[model samples]
Target: MIADSGRSVAFTGHRTYDGTAAESLSAAVERLYGRGFRTFLSGMAVGFDLAAAEAVLTLRAAHPDVRLVAVVPFRGQEERFSPADRVRFLRAVAAADEVEVLAGGYRRGCYAVRNDFLVDRAALVVAWYDGSPGGTRYTLRRALARGREVWNLHPSGGGLAIRPVQPALF
Candidate 1:
């Protein structure tokens, strides 16, 4: 069982993933599990968001105690996606142990709201960010400001870079 609500992790990344990104993501999830994080939160966006969720799901086979929570930006968030994308989104939501809708309908800065919520609820943040200007970077900054532990699999310089699995001293 989850040790506490703080024993959770959140993911943030760009829609476009770099090569070897998936492998790096899976490895990080496994390490997080080893570190006693039993809950994983995702924004349920395309690319890295879905990839991170799927990684948690795969690890779930061996780490059945873990939970996947999907945080959607708005009610009809996936309605504008292609048919295949909509199906994929639905499947991911269905796989989640819990779903959180940030708003009843789409609104300006809704994406930011979703990203902030993920960081707020988790003690650990795992992301694939290149320091580009986007939600991933914004979430990373928020996580840092909140003093959450973070691991950047693919940061600006490139390659796998994970923070030590220890609580932040601050």
Candidate 2:
């Protein structure tokens, strides 16, 4: 996702860990931050969500003004987080300039609904996709349909490749 001044961006992706994919995602976040993005919205899930939030915090040390917005799908989603992971997540949320929870509890399909909330409010989306048909893929498809620019990070051999989509010129 291309960074725009005073606009927030959202992130979505698989909750599975892939080392190369994680590194690639960090690079993507750094690139966006360098482009003047100051606010990031993330669902605070495992894998990609945690990774993205961590990256944002690391960047914040350098860009003290950068903000990480935790857009949680429900309360106690942090219960699923590991002790250390939960600590980090809580720190991110406390340090966050803003927080928004889309639902009160984990309803069926709540994650997808949360994704839609993020997409609806974001100027762009940064997604990690392994070409699978899951919530992240569904969110990306929705973003495309709505003409939102997306930056998809796909895992390659021990690394990541970025594919960015721009709004079509009429």
Compared with the true structure, all predictions reach lDDT values of: 0.80, 0.74
Over the stretch 7-116, how does candidate 1's per-residue lDDT look in tens digits? 99998888876435676677788878888899999898877888888888899889789899989999998897768668878988998888999899999999999998
TM-scores for every predicted model: 0.86, 0.81
Clashing pairs in 2: none
Please give, for residues 73-119, the per-residue lDDT of candidate 2 as tens digits.
89888988889778977887887767887788888998888888888
> Which stretches of candidate 2 lie above 4 Å from their native place?
1-6, 156-170
Winner by lDDT: 1
Note each model's CA RMSD in angstroms.
4.6, 5.7
Q: Cα miss at 28, model 1 (Å)?
A: 0.8
